[model samples]
Target: MKIDSRAASRTLAEIGNWRAVLLHGDDAGLIRERARACVRLVGGSTDDPFRVAILDADQHARIEEEAGALSLIGGRRAVWVREVQDSALAGVMAALSLDTDTLLVLEAPGLAARAKLRTTLEGHRSVAVIGCYPEEGRALAGSLSGLFRDASVSIDRDALTWLSSVLGADRGAVRQEVEKLILYAGEGGRLGLDDVQDCIGDSATATLDDATSAAMAGDRVSADTALERALAEGLSPIALARACLSLMTRLGKVMGWMDEGKSRQEALKQLRPPVFFRKAESFGKALERWDRETLARACEAVQGFERACKQTGSPDLALSRRLIAQLCLGPRSFRG
Candidate 1:
């Protein structure tokens, strides 16, 4: 039936029998995660031969026929579909509405507000929809903490935040990087920021850490080098500005705890994953130097920069360059 994801997940967890589900999310990873979670919920048999059969709209006839099939030798059976486009929703609706007794999982990209299939699932009396959005901030932190706990391992808070800042917004990508960090745990019972830094690859490294650090430190050379490298690597000024804004946001929250009677160590423990102790210090200094007003203004300016990048091409290059330069040069101060 049309159900909120929380309830659906709960139902799946307790009843353990999701006859048919339409698992929807903004990203592939979230869809897959929800799907796996659903499977786990149903107490599906793993030892029996199972199917990961994939079907597309072009093969609607095949999909419909397959959906009607009875469970094979498996104790439980599941059908998972990925990269579902809007064009396939109608057929998907038909397939899902049928009584299959099989788990028909639909993994689609974000649906349009007016989409027919979305409407169907939202209003369906027998189907469940799980929504997964691009995760960040608290959600990402929680996911990281859960990962460590599930693995019976512990991660440094600073390491988690630092790791998150480097990884792109993709939930799957972040999950992979965290897994790598866990793998890097080696023989040690506890993993720290240094191990994270050593294990994270160049692509996932928080380049902003260096650039923001350089800017905060008032090291013009380092900031300039980082910016140049970012540009060379194909990130527009808007991207850099947004990344910095996101970074500043998390840092500001950590700083807020300073006045909350929470020690840094305690705060770190409280934080999911964790922000690096060193980066936190730099962010604290930057916060004071920039102040609340300046940071807000800078974030607004960055939005404009993003618009310019999206609205034009070569002509906007100079404007973008100016924005990046201003982001770096805007008055520096240190609060010791």
Candidate 2:
């Protein structure tokens, strides 16, 4: 019962027929959004106390009991379990075996492809497993278009393109920003480039992108300043490290294409969420300065930074600054 993205909506519409639905992926926001959608589809609303039972990882043990409970109001109930872990597999399996009509919705983010819980439930006929990854490129643009269309707001092509490039990092963040844009425009209003820029030009994601791009281009002062602003705006240290890694990964891909005989412009054009025009010169310079081997090492270094930030007692902010400094200084050995 594994569902692809195209079939996800259809499956959710028919969710009442399924015993349980397992939503898993790296995009935690999308997982929660889909989980809420399932809840609303099964029960009338997500906040209905009588028909909706919400459980967290620690309360996973009660999943089965909640799933089997009948509603006093005489309709199907929905039991939502958030942040599910592998330890909850048994309870999930037990819940799926029940004969009741109540729906079970499990939000399990960061599950690997071969994780025991994912593999066990993926093929279950009565369970639906959906992967909720981050949307990018055309998918992201289309999503933004649909959001605006549904809100009855009109967005110009330039605004849509710019928003798509900046907003697809997280679904929940995109939704929040889109809601703001819609409110700013009001119903049946038109949104131009100026409107979106006025609304979200200084978003945290944009700042993080600026920091990573500056660091890649060895602009120490600009990188440090943007990093500071991003941190102050609530961007996490691990997220910053991951953004650096992502930039290196994209640069590495474009370099690979160039090595395969494609012109620099052609290779750069292949990048999803193509390099922002403002940053294109620096991005090209970064491609010229860092060879593939150096980019690989930089990726490793950023991964290590992420790991360090996750450890107890680690000085995350200091480590973040050090990582940015290393990137901007162009060290021969990032391991240092």
Candidate 3:
């Protein structure tokens, strides 16, 4: 069984069985929510949140064996594997093929068609695969309308478009912006584009947004300065590191898609905010400056910074500056 993220309500209603599910998306929260719903539907109690079983793929097979083999402690059992990508899931999946009583949730990032685990779950009648992507246009419209209707607020069409366009591939940001707008506009107040402009749109390209642009545009000085400003603003270097990695990754995917003969407009549509209309120009510059191999190297550099962020209390600002300076100029020249 496959459930689209857009059909969240319907999907929630249908997730009853204790089978396998592959919940994937860029938004980390939605995947958990859906999985929780599935756990609840399986007669699992939600009051005791920790009652649900949580395990990594390092022990997935062992956990899977135990889940299907024994009954829970008078409660439902759910085995959740986090950050387990499709390629690494072969043995674990092969193990799960032998049983079906426990709810197995495989949590991963976004799903490309090449994702083998996604394909397997899609083809499995006993398994469910759910994909969640950023919502836009009609989906967002319906969402905003729902949000407004819930609070009995009214928003103009232009304001809605501005909201949809400004919030990039970030789902949480969109939700937050809407919630902020609701409060700013107050209950029953009709919001126009000016209201959005006054609130979020005014600061659209204020801080990190500008830095993202500079980095994407291959402006080494601007990029470095932007990183400094962002770090000064208390944005964790780890978060910025991930954002840098994500920008390269998304830009590469979009560029590859365009190279496959996708129109510029189509590419624009495929990108999130900043990348769509306003920021696409800079992203194109970045892509031209750094090819696929360079982007791959950049990803590796970010991985190093990720480790530095997790393992040590290093001055991330200085480390980040060094990394950005090295990256903006060129690749991290390998010694070997």
| C-alpha lDDT of all candidate models, in order | 0.61, 0.85, 0.64
lDDT of 1 by residue, 49-149 (tens): 35444565456445556666666555445566665656666666666667766666677755555677767677775667666665666666777788878
lDDT of 2 by residue, 1-336 (tens): 899889987898888889889999867778998899999988989999889999987898899899888898887899999988789999988988888988889999877789889999987988999998877668889988999999999999878877876663667777988999999999999999889989987877667778888888889899999889878877777557656766787788899999999999899888877877777887987887798877888888888887788688999999988998989977465533
Error of 1 at 244 (Å): 4.8
With candidate 2 superimposed using the best TM-score fit, by how many Å does residue 91's alpha carbon deviate from the native?
Answer: 1.3
Over 117-168, each residue of candidate 3 has an lDDT whose tens digit, in order, gives 7777787787777786545446766777888878878988766755654444
The lowest-lDDT stretch of 10 consecutive residues in candidate 1 is 43-52
Worst 10 residues of 3 by lDDT: 201-210
Candidate 2, residue 150: Cα displacement in angstroms equals 1.6
Cα deviation of 8, candidate 3, in Å: 6.1
Candidate 2 regions exceeding 4 Å error are 269-272, 307-316
Query: How close to the true structure is residue 329 of candidate 2, measured as C-alpha lDDT?
Result: 77
What's the residue-level lDDT of 231 in candidate 1?
A: 56
**Candidate numbers, best lDDT first, in rank order:** 2, 3, 1
Q: What is the lDDT of residue 135 in candidate 2?
A: 74
